[model samples]
Target: MAVTRQLTGIQVRGLLGRFDHEIIFPESDEFIILHGPNGVGKTMLLELIQSLSGTLRIPSIHRTPFSEVRLTYSDGTQFEVSKALQETLPLGEELEKQIQRLIFRLRLPDGQEISSTAGFDSEELASPRFRDWASRVLDLEPVGPDIWLTTGGYTISSLELLHKYSDRLPTRALRTGGGKVDARILAFLGENEVHLIETQRLLTLEDPDSSEFRRGSTRTPAVSKVESFARDLTRRLADALAENSRTSQELDRTYPRRVLQAHTEYPSEEKIRERYSEQNELRKSLSAISLLDENVGRIEIPKKMEPWQRNVLWTYLEDTEKKLSTFSEILAKVSLLQEIVNTRFLYKRLEIDRRRGLRLVSEEGTELGLSMLSSGEQHELVLLYDLLFNVQPGALVLIDEPEISLHVSWQKRFIEDLQRISRLVKFRSVVATHSPQIAGKWINRMVSLGPGTTD
Candidate 1:
């Protein structure tokens, strides 16, 4: 398998046909804060980067209003995307002509370039199958050849809808813009891993299998992401427990033979005691998260024991160590999440429950539902959960308007929290925010996006 490249820099010219911007991430620091005022394409730039990243549609790159975009990777290679200027097509143009209206070129790292007439076919967009997909994924009505009516009483064009709802469409749907050029572009950029957390971080899809989000429909269902993630964590803990059970059963079945044949030299009593202390502390940590039984307490080892007794105890400790290692990854993530969120919450405590996934408790010992959290609290929880759980190691995370719904104090702590998360999870992050508190003292990490400037 080919290795995916890590994005190290971004360059865009004529963003919105007025502003130019460049950002180069520091080698040592994983955080890049994009500091700029509104309408300067801060969010649009993130969108373009994400769209160019392999996880999104290839044709959408041409739809963005940038003269050109160049992404530099850690391997000293660059991928450049640019659009060939064209006159606006008149209304009522033929579908075939419209399919080839906008031309886009993707320049590869090796000095080779490929081009595609970047537009989807109207017939394809108007097909019964496509309409069914749109209905299922977005709950939009296909009203015409290139027009869709939303539940909000608003009509959207095919390209606009495709760009706006790109995340909702499946890969196969986006693949309808078929061409050899698109295939090459997709192949070249497909190795990159990228994730985007939009400003509206609190809303989540009610249906797991469908992307049916209706902006203004009373019938559209929505769920609090905090509640949703709690359920997800519950399932993860259940899986880990099941795996641990299997491992314990296998080890127990061979315990007798291992204990009987133990002629190996045992560690000194002091060393044995130290290992016991360490393991005991580990058990207690996991127990706090419900990964282990709450009966775990500091264990006291006897100073004197027969050789056989010592060997049996050593064997048990070894087995216990193996069993507890099952929760190592989960423990690190949950612990960090708790540390960050609990510190910011004024009177509430966050706990992990084996059956409930995430449990929020009041200071007076009252259990709080996910809905009880204020919008700021919910945003903090949802964003942290996504960064810790949904994103993979070495992937690039794009966070837009992270200060939204956050207090000034929480905003100030945001960068520090990200720094801690980066140390544990190992991913590059690009934060776009208007809050000076969000930047705090990270002046070296700030990338200001403005007119005719590079940072």
Candidate 2:
């Protein structure tokens, strides 16, 4: 079941520096977003909060175990962790700025100290009590390299930041390896796993067609069949029937987790080999789908937006075109590689060819179709991949001025569709945009940040 998150608060310390203005806070949600114009300290705000956990610069913190920090969270909480630096012991330490650790002291319901100053390094390391409230509260983790940070003289690129600290990206991630799975497909698998595990146990019991799994006395399926049965029977439950079956099966397989314990050694030899081969095939298709998906997110651009966006998109698309043109006979195969950017007449030989056509009237028509695809065709495939990619969990999509390179209709319609799909797929998008219409789609999550914002 989809769960709601609490609006618990966080106190940030070791900030490179606190924001001069108060940072806003929302009561509850699985994720939080921040955005703003250049120099508004959008990056700074994310860094400050990220520091509260771990993932960015430590030694360059604005404050430290060393004291005094700015707060960007809410106005309500039973108690907050307050502390003063032990200044007296730093007679000659040069006031270290690096924060090696961020320790959060929690006040228990029984008014007891959960720790005697002995704390864990990360949130996961924190005691069970703290995790129950904090883990689900923040749920922030690094999705991949698209992390954006400006702390410690570092420029975090699109492949460097994640809202949550999970290794879910193509790089080195946990249990989920880089198998060419688009982010969305990966998420679908996870949701399926959650539902399938339980459905297996009960579905087999309800329809015990195979006597191989019958229990000694009861009509229960065999231990090994439990897992397979759930996966099979759950697969049988389609969209509408899924909910009904999931509900009933959930009750039947209430002890699904416990069932996993029965298979002491894991999957049988035959099934293990079968899975290995199946996984290889899945990865090949997944890679192609992911490559095409990056373009779909491009559809979010608004019709009436800023100029920098159009300029960026134009330059990028033009550059790619020039390179590909060199391989074939495109417009006498313009020598883009030989052209100079600052030349007075860079486009001296350029002509508006919006009405251009590719003529291939022969058995080689199939070959011509491959060589002369229109820009619009490329854009559509990109959008398709983007649509598929959003179904994955913990995706951090960094879209820079997403309002360019396509029709206005695609921009509007895809915005609404993308938002709905992203949520179901476990994605957290951070876009640098100027379109109010695009921003409106993600209104509840808007966190504008950039330079000129104080810290």
What is candidate 1's CA lDDT for residue 395? 78
- The weakest ten consecutive residues by lDDT in model 1 span 91-100
The sequence of per-residue lDDT tens digits that candidate 1 reaches over residues 71-177 is 88776667776665433323234322322234445665677767665544444455677677677657788877677899899998776775686555544443322
**Predictions in order: lDDT:** 0.77, 0.32
Residue-level lDDT tens digits of model 2 in 79-197? 22233322111212322222222223334344543211111122222224322222232222322222233435444432122222222221211111112323332232233211001
Candidate 1 lDDT for residue 327: 85
Q: Candidate 2 regions off by >4 Å?
A: 1-33, 47-101, 106-415, 426-434, 441-455
Flag clash pairs in model 1: none
lDDT of 2 at 261: 35
